[model samples]
Target: MSPNSTDAMKTNLGEAGAHLKNAATDAGSAIKNAAHVAGDELRMGRSAVKADLADSALAGIAALEEGGGAAREQMDQLMDKGRDLIDSAADLIRERPIASFGAAFAAGWIIAKLARSGDR
Candidate 1:
């Protein structure tokens, strides 16, 4: 081969090698950037999930507190009603001792009968 042709071939091969090296570097850089983007997206998604879970927990606690307040109010009302009933019973017993005693005896007898029947 002529010396000029051999030199030209060498130059072409060198240029091709440089281009391949540049392409490989670019591909490596692109891969690294993609990994960083993927990692950032995952972090953001995890933070959003955590925030949603915290909100749901807060809502659950509020619901429980509201339900507990309602139950407490209902219990207070039931206690008041029971007190009133006991006061009425006491007044009735004081006004009619004999009637109350007779009624109590009848209630006891009926309860005993019901118990015996249930056992059978």
Candidate 2:
């Protein structure tokens, strides 16, 4: 090649190298900016997930408390029914003292006889 052509080619190659270097530097900056944006978005998403979990926990606690209240109410009703049964039995016993005593004696005698029979 002639001297002029060689110098021209070297100058062109240098310009191309500079352009490539600029492009690489710009790409690195763009990649760093994208990573920062992604980090910010991830931090916001983490907080959103935590809030959702907290709301779900509160809902679960409310449901459990409601269930507990229902169970307590049912237990109270059962206790009242048991008290009614006891009251009726007491009234019956009071009204029929002699008959209750006779029946008790007969039941004891029968149970003793059956228990002795099993032993024999």
Candidate 3:
């Protein structure tokens, strides 16, 4: 080959090699940046999941507390109703002693039978 042609060919090969090296370096840097961004996104997603769980737990606790309050109020109302029933029965017994006595005996007999059956 001519000396000039050989030199030109050598220069072209060297330029091609440099371009390939630069491309490899840029590819490596891009891969590293992508990995870092993915890691940060994963951590943020985990934090959001944890926060959502905590909020759900708090909401469940609040619902349980509200249910307990309603139960307590119902119990208070039942006790008041029981007190009224007793007062009315007492008034009836005072007005009619003989009839009240007979009714009380019948109720006692029925209660005794229920207790005996429950024991079985």
Better of 1 and 3 by lDDT: 1
Per-prediction TM-score: 0.62, 0.68, 0.69
lDDT of 2 by residue, 1-120 (tens): 567988999999999999999999999999999999999999999999999999999999999999999999999999999999999988988999999899899999999999999998
Q: List lDDT for all candidates, in order.
A: 0.99, 0.97, 0.98
Better of 2 and 3 by lDDT: 3
User: Which is the better candidate, 1 or 2, if ranked by TM-score?
Assistant: 2
Candidate rank order under TM-score:
3, 2, 1
Error of 2 at 65 (Å): 2.7
RMSD of each: 4.0, 3.6, 3.6
Runs in model 1 deviating more than 4 A are: 1-14, 84-100, 110-120
Q: Pick the candidate with the highest TM-score.
A: 3
TM-score of 1: 0.62
Residue 77, model 1: lDDT of 100
lDDT of 3 by residue, 17-90 (tens): 99999999999999999999999999999999999999999999999999999999999999999999999999
Query: Which residue window of length 10 is worst by lDDT in model 2?
Result: 1-10
Question: Which pairs clash in model 1?
Answer: none
